[model samples]
Target: MSTERRAPLDRKRVADTALKLLNDVGLDGLSLRAIARELDVKAPALYWHFKDKQALLDEMATEMYRRMVAGTALDPGDTWQERLRKSSHGLRGELRGYRDGAKVFSGSRFTGIEHAEQMEDTLRLFTAAGFTLAQAVRATATTYLYTLGFVTEEQGVEPLPDERREGYDVAERARRMSDFPLAARAGAEIFADYDRHFEEGLELVLAGIAVRFGGS
Candidate 1:
């Protein structure tokens, strides 16, 4: 074996490697051992950075959020509705970028305070748009939860943009639900054209927020 010095590892490097491995081994198969093997280090080396798998996952989720924020910029002149739409879509895009990405992101906490800045900005935007502080938090949470839940289900069907799991065939589903006439017909609408469906659902969520919170 060739003897070559390796770069020192940190939390960011560990989390970054784990994120890339996520696309291959997925969340279930990912572990500190696997990450350590990829990094050419002993598994114990990782413990210096992450206490356990959940800690590493939190860091990975934070990295994902950081990348999402870095890549997306909202227009300052846009109305609250427009900003919400853009932020929602941007989040969906980021979550869909990896296998089991939404799952990885769901329920994971940030390892640092980096996300607070974005949260502050979002709350400010909503409050500036005529919502009280409480209303702003609720409105933002509503949209965020909708996006998170939507993408989780979306990833369940298509883990990646071009890769769809088995058992979701529309015709097969329609046939399976034949006894329920309307439900049988609804299969196609529910299963196909994810982009259009996501947009329509997002619009509905936005509409509800507007009606309840009095935003433009």
Candidate 2:
């Protein structure tokens, strides 16, 4: 008889399995036990790497950030405005890549300093463009928050890319809001073409930052 030898368990392996299971079961259903089952190990095994569910979530969020940074390459020649736009777009793509991905990342802290390098680079970009240190932090944070909030709502509408929840139909929304003619008509503009809407909204944000911060 032949038997398969499993890879040794570690924090990365545990976090990786949890991220995959996250899509199948979602945040509420994701637990160390479920991850253990996927890894063919006991629940206690996960505790050795992660103290609790929140710790695992922190790791997962960090992993998502790591992957996003790995896949994105910001040109040194790009303006702060261009960098901000590209970074926000890249972040949105990463958050939308998994089920409840934004939710997983939203409130969790990174388990280590792996994210510090990226954070430093972003702050430097803004400061180089003439923003004060505080302003640089704020500007970077504002765009980050916008991307997070946008993707959170986007994922709420469609938990998985292949799956969209019901009750978002434009005609039905319009019918329900028939008494408010203008609001009813707004449904068509709001529910569809998220890509275009995201770009437009991002532009508005960038414009506001430029007006307020005097960045190029």
TM for every model, in the order presented, reads: 0.95, 0.96
lDDT of 2 by residue, 153-177 (tens): 9888888767877988888999999
lDDT, residue 45, candidate 1: 95
- The Cα local distance difference test for each model comes to 0.88, 0.88
Q: After superposition, how far is residue 124 of candidate 2 from its true place, in Å?
A: 1.8
Clash counts per candidate, in order, are: 0, 0
Instruction: Report the lDDT tens digits of candidate 1 across residue range 123-170.
Output: 777777788999888877888899999888988899889988999999
Clashing pairs in 2: none
Model 1's TM-score against the true structure: 0.95
Global Cα lDDT for candidate 2: 0.88
Q: In TM-score terms, which candidate is top?
A: 2
lDDT, candidate 1, at 205: 87
What CA RMSD would candidate 1 show? 1.4
